[model samples]
Target: MAATARDIAAELRERIKSGALAPGKRLPGEPALVQEYGVAKETARRALTMLVTEGLAVRRKGSGTYVREFQPIKRVANRRLAPEGWGSGQSIWSADLNTRPMEVTKLRVDVESAPDNIALALNLTDGARTLVRDRVYVVEGEPVQSATSYLPADLVRGSAIEQEDTGPGGVYARLEELGAKPVRFVEEVRARMPAPDEVERLHIAEGTPVVEIFRTAFTDEGTPVEVNRMLLDASAYVMEYHVTS
Candidate 1:
């Protein structure tokens, strides 16, 4: 009996876990796998494809498959959202990156009609105007996340939130100045396959999924101030939440 493609892939996966195949090290090519496993070329190819889809390996154009060099960003949900994190003139995102540099690119600020769902989240009338902030977050020159925020136009019309740079503490701090500080937040998270546009924007590979987060920021009085929708590369992030009893 011949070993299946999955059997070969399982062996490779174990090697990777054991550091026998270190990050960036090339995996055996299809020809090599075929000769070693007595398997067909397609079986060898499928074996490699499995690793690629699982994010355990990467395929470079014109080169063989290699173990993925993974240093995933740890996203600390609770700490990052805490008032003390961004309230004292710091970026909320700083909690996640630590010393690692995270760049914001493709920033676009505009006043647009809020989608029905967003409007509802922000407690606005249908088609109400919103100040929309859209941007992509990159680390090591790789796009890792895209975030779009919606706030009532009337709340942020003349504020620095409309600017390309929101100054020291980003939007939440600015919102505080306007008397709508976000003292509480609620986030809903889900994972799914990326859409075509998302695939292009985030440079996501086929079969890679994305994490979608809808975070609503609320004032002390429970008035929702902003609704932010974020799409993160699943392979590039390790979601961390510190729960308290």
Candidate 2:
């Protein structure tokens, strides 16, 4: 019997898993695969496509298919949301990332009506506009996540939260100063295929999915202070939550 494309793909998958095919190393081009595997062009193409769909390889336009360089960042729920992490003076990101670099590639502040879901979470009445803070987070020069925060327009009208930097500890710190500090948080996470815009913004490879996180911040009095929606590249993060009894 002839060696099927599945056989070729299985062999290549093992090579990638065993580190024989290092990240960034180009894979065999279609012609090369056909010649080496003695398979038809269609079979060779299917083999390569299989690898890509499995996230083991990435296809680049004008370049070629190569092993993926996936450096997954950990998103630790407890540590990142602790008061000491962002309420004091440290950035929440400091709780999870090591010495690797992370930056905000884009920042946009505006006043807009909250989306239906966001409005419900923030307890905003109909037609009420909120102050929106949107930012794109990059790690190691690669786009990883984008977050948009919604705060009551009246509550943060003149505060530094309206500014680009949001000061040392960010919005959480400002909320503290306003006597509406975030005392509790609820977060929900969901995953699905990336949207067209999300793929372009994050520069994600084809067949990669995205994780969506919705978080609501509340004051001790049970008043919701902020609602945040975050979209993350699934290939670049490990989401973890610690529960205490």
Candidate 3:
């Protein structure tokens, strides 16, 4: 009886968790695993692949698999969305970053016809136009999330929200300046296998899933002001929400 890939992967997982294999350290390659476990090369490869698929390891082309080095970001939903955080010239994202630096890349702002769901979320009629802002969020040079925000074009057309850089508290602040300040939010979240573009954009491993979030922001009058769709690398985030009754 020979050890299966799962057996080897399990052992390796424990070793990684126990810090025997430090982050960025290469794991035993196929040949080494083959000899150590007395298993076929395919079995050894599958073992390594399992670790990669689980997000515990990464395969480097022309190199060997290494323990994943990127630290997971803690996303605090309630704190980040609280108006107090963003209303006083502070960015809502600051709650999540602490001292860590997160960069926005590939930012694009355009006016387009809203998608059906987005239009509905914003209480717009069919084919309503929106100001679409799209960007990728990167930490330590690794892309961890992508987001697209849709705001009613007529409402934001002349506002700072139409710019690539929404100053100070970001879009919410701009909306407030325009008398459409967001006072409440609702978020819907789901996990699913990554689409091809998401895999490329987030640099996610095969078999890795993504978390999709749709957040709708409304003003005190309960009029929807913005709809934001975010796709997050599941391996790169630990979502936290504060709840109260």
Report the number of the highest-TM-score candidate.
3
Runs of candidate 1 with Cα error greater than 4 angstroms are: none
Q: How far is candidate 1 from the true structure (C-alpha RMSD, Å)?
A: 1.4
Instruction: Give lDDT tens digits, candidate 1, residues 115-146.
Output: 99999999999879999999999987778899
> Candidate 1 vs candidate 2: which has greater TM-score?
1
Task: Write down the RMSD of all candidates, one decimal each.
Answer: 1.4, 2.2, 1.3
The 10-residue segment of model 3 with minimum total lDDT is 91-100
Would you list the C-alpha lDDT of every candidate in the order shown? 0.92, 0.88, 0.92
The residue pairs found clashing in candidate 1 are none
Per-residue lDDT of 1-245 in model 2, one digit per residue for the tens? 66688888898899998999999899998899889888899998888888876667878888888997866688899989899878678888988786778899788999998888878888989988999999899988789899999999989989999999888898999999999999899988999998898899888777778999889999999999999999988877888888889
Tens-place lDDT per residue, model 3, 1-245, is 89999999999999999999999999999999999999999999999989987778998999999999988888999899888888887877788888778899999999999999888899999988999999999988889899999999999988888888889999999999999989889999999999898899889998889999999999999999999999999888899988889
User: Candidate 2 — which pairs collide?
Assistant: none
